[model samples]
Target: MKLHTIDTGFFKLDGGAMFGVVPKAIWNKTNPADDKNLCTWAMRCLLIEDGKRLILIDTGIGNKQDEKFFSHYYLHGNATMDSSLAAKGFHRDDITDVFLTHLHFDHVGGAVIRDGEKLLPAFKNATYWSNRQHWEWAVNPNDREKASFLKDNILPIQQSGRLKFVSAQDGVSFTDDIKIKFAYGHTDAMMLPLINYKGKQVLYMADLLPSAGHVPLPYVMAYDMFPMKTLDERKIYWNEAVEQQYILYMEHDPVNECCTLQQTEKGIRIKDLFKLEEM
Candidate 1:
């Protein structure tokens, strides 16, 4: 199996929202914010080439939204979904599965594309993967998360008859070497893919752990529905990551692509940081 980092681009999000209760004095040291309190973040995606299946995890915020909508989150960078795919000698049609960790606009936006007036699935021949519970929650989003779950980015897959719901069972095998782990704190039933690559396990840190800055226990995102739940989940996973020596594939970290945790006197902290290709 081969894994490639598909960088769609970078966007700015409020640092305060990204670092929950963590003070700016603390988080600023890692993710510095601009005058507007917005910090730049990478909308990094992952491509998995396993035998006959080419699976893509998370489509970074697509370029379909209107000017007014995009003005809110400044999307910048030369890398694009198509360009990144082409770099790997692949195309959108080459993808067999799009495994969405959640339905947030920034994560699933590129799943669909704007074709004139109609919204369509970006991966024409690929089956869009989502879970039943998260699908329902995203479609009928609560007021707090409504803005993040855009209909243009989601409904098209179901409308196109290419959407499939994976089993909600935790640790369920999505493929022979890929297992799905579910976390609820970030959003309802957010799916994290645990992939076995080169005889080692790699955990896709969707929003469960957005960046190395979030390695410390209290650094939960304000966007999480249940911050306390996230804390508990982190404690459990952090220890497992250290014990099992799992490589964490980060989605939103601008500089760091992957990292491993080490047990310290305080708690679990990053042992080393490196790119996925280094593996």
Candidate 2:
């Protein structure tokens, strides 16, 4: 199986919100926000080429939002979903599966696009994969998360009759190399894909660990509904990652694409940093 890093684009977000309780004095050294205090982040997606089945994991925030809506996030970057895929000699229709880690706008926005008056699947031929529990939670999001679950990004997949839910429970295997791990803290039933690639195991650390700076256990995001639950989830996942030597594939990290954990005296900390292609 061949794995390719598909960089959809980058956007700016409030650094304080991204790091939650962590002080900017610390996070700034790593992320370094702009004058507007917005930290640039990459909406990095992954394309899994396992034989003929071309699966694109987590489409980045699409370009359907209005100018006023986009003014808030400040989306900037030369790379886009279409151009990035074309660089690798493929197109959206070549994608057989759109595996969404969660329903957040930045993560699943590219799954659907606005086609004049109608909203439809960006990949008309692909089956959009999302868990049943996550599907329900996103469609009826609470006040705190409502903004992230945009109807334009989500509802269209179900409306297009291309959405599918995996019956496989938590820690369930999706394919011979890819396994789905569930984290509830970030959002309800956020599925992190643990993939085996080229004799190495790589965990797609969606929002659970958005960037390399988030490798430290206490660096949970304010956006997480249950921060306490996130702490526990991180402990469990980090321990396993350290033990198994998993290469974490970060989606939102602007500079660092991948990192690994080491058994530090304080706790598990980043042992090394590199891009996915470096591995």
- lDDT winner: 1
Model 1 residue 81 lDDT? 96
TM-score, candidate number 1: 0.99
**Prediction RMSDs, each to the true structure:** 0.7, 0.9
Among the numbered candidates, top TM-score falls to 1
Each prediction's whole-model lDDT (CA): 0.95, 0.92
Model 2 error, position 38 (Å): 0.9
**What lDDT score is found at residue 34 in candidate 2?**
92
Model 1, position 38: C-alpha lDDT score: 97
Model 2 lDDT tens row, 90-146: 999899999999999999888888889999899988998999999999999999999
lDDT of 1 at 29: 98
